[model samples]
Target chain A: MTDRILAVVTLNMDIVAGGAPIFFARNQEEQVKMARYLARTLDAMVHDLENGVYIIVKH
Target chain B: MEHYLGTIIAGTLAGTVARMVMLRLDYRQYPGYPHGYLSHLSLGFIASALGAVAIPAILKPDYTAVTFLALAASQFREIRGIERKTLEHLDENELVKRGSDYIEGIARTFEARNYLAMACALLTGIAYELGRAPAAIIMALLSIIFVRTFMAGETIGDICEVVPAKLWFKDSILMVENIGFINIGLKEIREKITAEGLAVLITPKNADARATIHDLGQRQAMAHTVTVLLGTKKDVDLPEFTPLARIDPDSGAVGLYAVPVERDIDALILAVKRTPVLESARSRPLKTQAGRMAAR
Candidate 1:
């Protein structure tokens, strides 16, 4: 867990921030799950844009 | 003896009538059961009894008895607290939650109603003590009518125009007429909304009306009233499908989207029109000289 933005999970199944596309999710539900997992494990926060993006930031 | 009986009958009748007129079980379903009604009625009775006895007590040189009126005022204030607590508790389960402002307004209304009942009782008692049976009966009827008129608040239609709007998605973003509502990237949710949803555009007649409708609590109240009349397709999980009132930045007109259980568009329109203006959301800027000058 680092004190920086870990990854950004776009609802369209793309990891825009962290390199190597850390989590590949099928749909919105999986996207949310993966985002939460990244947030919890990485000690981060999930910012749901309510459009199609969830930006995860390490706390 | 005759005057005493007349005062008792007149005061009780006036207070009871006022309470009955105010105790309504509409969409809110407040005072929903018989027990609730009984409690209010009993309170009304006690209020009237106190009011009716005031004149006689004063005549008998008992000044301390008037303190009971102050005691009743405190008791009625407690009713406001009870109403707030009850509504707040019930709000947790509401699909479209009534905001705290609305809840506070309702609680205040209940408290005010009890005071109105007390005032009516006191007035009727005075009239009866002065003019006897016939005057007492006449005053009671007049008091009921006056109470009814006073309590009749303004409705949404009085302030704005509610018209049907075409609900369509432009580039997968929901719009009512030209006003933007919600951005939905999901095709299924968009399709479901288009297939079943009803849309209405509420354009405020004037600047004051615009200010009133701009209040989020008022918009929510409009949604709740529409849901109560036409029902909503909303469930717990689906936030996108929930009834929403979005304002157009350019026009200040509100766009409403709701997928009703009953697809009666006319009834939905009527319900929106009939939705009572929430007290918390009322803003009469145009009535002020500064606002009028600014507008000019």
Candidate 2:
């Protein structure tokens, strides 16, 4: 079993606001892909404001 | 005695006439943006006359400067308490549906200030006979407080007094507080740990603060400023330090990171972006079957 169980899962996209679904990927790549997949559909605000923010992931 | 009566009559008439003019303009501008600016202008003029009265009132046996302040402060504090619907969860289409609502909201916020600024100006005129800067310092300090927060009690004077920035940061912050209304007092904090100079602001929405009727809409939309102090920098200020946070291509360093921490926040940000939805909202042009085949 992975030590990093799905504590909280959330997408880093703002289009859906706070209602998007997310899953716990075990690694960084999983995190990035999960981010890209969910993010591509939304029109990302291209400001430097959201670059390093780890949007709260839902459990 | 004659001048005092004249002043009162003059103020009342001026306020009434000014309001009538504004109301007239307000009527004309309808079906477009609401003409709220009229309130600010009229209120300012009206209050200036009333402020002249405040001077004599202050000298009376019962009236203290604080009494005038209490009246204005209480009135303003009451106005600051207002209802603001959270449009944060709204999508682009919804945003457009209530698009004009934002402007209406902005106008409301401005006019509300007109009320207090007018009250203060009126009080100033009344207080004029008292002394130099009698309440001027207090007024300046109070203005700093109100302008910074756009709300009472959250002013920089209050904040700085309670929570002084690190000694190194005190001056830049004073500059910020001094700049006051010129810059929205919304602040975020970001710091860079790498040689690349990456800056990430960590501003979690304060979920615990009370949402007063006065605290609605405008206060929620933006923060005043962002303060970043990594370890210590004895030699820098806000503007001087701000540039350090921007990306420098020549040096291959990332300047600012714009991510939210709470997943819900990212969802919120992503959900609100309108550029994607406008395309989704409209129907595509119809194509003839033959034309579709030709294109394909």
Candidate 3:
């Protein structure tokens, strides 16, 4: 299986854009919660872009 | 044929015993079940029979019977293919995979063991024909000892040193001592890893070993072996807990990170050290002049 960006969870909406589904959270807590949920649902890993964005990747 | 009965029996017994001595149910755990053992032992018996018949056939001036040894060689090649297929099928479901290199190494070893068994039988037959039962017994023991010692390959510990390393978090990035491992975005998961995860640095003894461990397949084999022995906390969905082996490009050292069910550091180190060095991953650069100059 190839790695794909399943979703993007971010505090800042301006940082990420493109084909992957994006979710914007109000703060770090909500972003972590959303990323964890998306990761569980998608069976993917949450990688921090470290730019107020977390990308959920299926590897 | 009656005159050769004792020679044939002695040779076949020695060959089968040699195969049994080589077949071990080790931590690698392949061919561990009864069914696997039965199939291999049966093949060993057939190979021994083939080897035993060769000397008598030549003595009887029946040259055609000796051609069966060529057939035996082809059959052993099939054993290697069968082993590779079985392992590849099993790897699909493993949480941590024994990479292709490791699988190939295992397959090759299985094929070689059969040859060793055949050789043991042939030698015992020759000895029995020349000097009777006593010489045959001594030859069997010598050949079995040779197979056990010389046929066995080196392990990770033979070429590298495994030492425990501290796991820390540099923000979202997990660090194994000075080497940066992975980027874990989840705070709770990162905290769990920092608190419980085990890390180790595999330092190569020389340039040849450095190049060998630099192979991606070798690193993956190390990760798979460590996870299997230590019982990983990883599940299908829990990619965060999956073990990883990362290399330090500057020093050519590999760092392994794992969250095991049994949190024993000593066991983890032992498990890594015991992993067989994959033949496909072996690199001997020091043999070359340019490599020797670079090492200097």
Model 3 lDDT per residue over B24-83, tens place: 623274748889888989998988888887878888889998898999999999999999
DockQ of each: 0.11, 0.02, 0.82
Off by over 4 Å in 1: A1-15, A18-59, B25-31
Q: Model 3 clash pairs? A: none
User: lDDT score, residue B294, model 2?
Assistant: 39
Q: Pick the candidate with the highest TM-score.
A: 3
- For candidate 3, give the docking quality class from DockQ: high
Off by over 4 Å in 2: A1-59, B5-36, B39-50, B56-69, B83-255, B258-296
List the lowest-lDDT window of 10 residues for candidate 1 chain B.
B24-33
Residue A9, model 1: lDDT of 73
Q: What is the lDDT of residue B254 in candidate 1?
A: 91
lDDT of 3 at A17: 82
**What is the iRMSD of the candidate numbered 3?**
0.7
Per-model CA lDDT versus the true structure = 0.78, 0.30, 0.89
